[model samples]
Target: MSFVVAVDGPSGSGKSSTARGVADRLGFAYLDTGAMYRAVTWALLQRGVDTADAAAVAATVGEVRIDSGTDPLAPTIAADGIDVAGPIRSDEVVRHVSPVSAVPQVRTRLVDLQRRVIVGTDAPGIVVEGRDIGTVVATDAPLKVFLVADPQARAERRAAEEGGSDTAATAASLQRRDRIDSTRAASPLAKADDAVEIDSTHLSLDEVIGRIVSLVEERR
Candidate 1:
């Protein structure tokens, strides 16, 4: 049986990295849903749409197309035929993505697209990570994991990974993202009731991956 894993977590949590690592070890496809939202947000920003206007924001959903690879090691995304693989993760997109993603129309479009990717892919299964994967997009996924960490540890980890910012600012940024993501109207960041919550604050990356592997094997 194909094993789809739904991983959901708040900003600065180790969801992205841990999901990618788990996918690599299990030979499963990795779906970065956050990048998709960021890419769409970037497209709307490029077009000069007012960030606060829901109708305006939703109008551009058709113009932006997100394409990602199934490979765990290689991640990619594009917006409006433009290769935004790198820029989507920039500070600009990061700041506004929550507002854009919060729009009802925007979420509707992206969620449909995400479902297509998960169902259409040839990979045996996909490990999807985002704010609402377990709650919305892949609710029926057999393996659901909600990764979390202390706010301080999350900030430190984010700061260390980001090459362009100081730890203090990175911490502040993550705090802002957490507020935005959790407060958004559409499929806000939440842990599923059945999801296994893992506190990765003090755990090593290997430890996290091993735990997920154990979960997967048990399911198998």
Candidate 2:
């Protein structure tokens, strides 16, 4: 039986890390759906499309081709055939990604692609991490996890990852993003009713990974 694990969380909640670790431990494919959205945002900026103009941003969906690598050890993302794993992490993309992802048309396109990736993978299964994985992308996933941390902890983690960024600003930005993402019309960030929610504020990355791995084992 294919064991699908859907992990959903906001920024800095350790979704990417935990999902990758779980996938690696279980020898499953890892799909980072957020990277796909970031690729689209990066593509929009590269093409000079007005992000605020929802119509304009949606119009570029056909022109942008996002390719995501699901390897747990070396996940990669590309936008329009250009390597964008690094560029999409820029502050500029961070500031605009929520708006770009909120476009209903963009979500429709990427969600379809994400579903395809999950269905087409040859691995035993896949660990898919995203804001709406449990809620939208993989509602039928056998193992669903929703991770959360306090705002301060999330900010500190994000700052650490960004190489000494300002924690206060990062916290504010995270809050703004949470509001935008939670309230968006299309596939808004949400925890699935059946998802197991984990508060990771005080947990180590390995601990979180272990917990999810254990859950997968029990399900198996």
lDDT of each: 0.85, 0.92
Provide the RMSD of all predictions against the true structure, rounded to 1 decimal. Answer: 1.3, 0.8
Backbone-clash count (model 1): 0
Off by over 4 Å in 1: none
Top TM-score model: 2
lDDT of 1: 0.85
Candidate 1 all-Cα RMSD: 1.3
Q: TM-scores, in order shown? A: 0.95, 0.98
Candidate 2, residue 83: the lDDT equals 96
User: Which regions of candidate 2 fall more than 4 Å away from where they truly are?
Assistant: none
Q: How big is the positional error of residue 141 in model 1, measured in Å on the Cα after superposition?
A: 0.6
